[model samples]
Target: METAVADRKDTLDVEDLAELCRALGHPARVRILEFLKKMDKCICGTIVDSLPLAQSTVSQHLKQLKSAGLVKGEIEGPRTCYCLDRERLDQFKQYVANL
Candidate 1:
């Protein structure tokens, strides 16, 4: 293996925060989080009922959550279920605590 020099400076703690914050930047996502937090877990279509936005819009927000690792989704036959990723949430919280 070859040794490599590492940068001693230039860091952005906001990378993770930026990803998460961007995913949550929309009002739809904020509502989705609230709904999921209340139920703790829910089917994909179930999220549509809680928000005034279109189902497709809600799906996009869910996609953002998935990308941010804030939510986990899996197919169940013809439906999809979503639930919080507690690990990521805890990690993010710890990041905030350190700041």
Candidate 2:
């Protein structure tokens, strides 16, 4: 049936969803996402200040999130401003619901 085929197509799209999951596998990354969700955008130093992590650790987590397309970063002068990619976050939620 067409419905079954469509379901198959969605299943085939799991690779990206899996990458998202891996990015979120760490507790620190999840917390980073939650923090970003609350703010419009913030620099890496602000994120470091909010968490117990060192700046470099926080930067690494942000990098992973950005790589997974769950976060977006824009360079502003000396800092990189970070925020949740709401569309991708929604897509991740949809993927989980489908599973």
- Clashes in model 2: which pairs? none
Tens-digit lDDT track of model 1 for 55-93: 998888899998999899989999999998878878778
Instruction: Give lDDT tens digits, candidate 2, residues 8-89.
Output: 9877778888899999999999999999999879888899999998889999999999999999999999989999999999
In order of appearance, the predictions have TM-scores of 0.82, 0.87
| lDDT of every model, 2 decimals | 0.81, 0.92
RMSD in angstroms between candidate 2 and the native structure over all alpha carbons: 2.0
Model 1 residue runs over 4 Å out of place are 1-12
> After superposition on all CA atoms, what RMSD does each candidate show versus the true structure?
3.9, 2.0
In candidate 2, stretches whose alpha carbon ends up further than 4 angstroms from where it belongs are 1-11
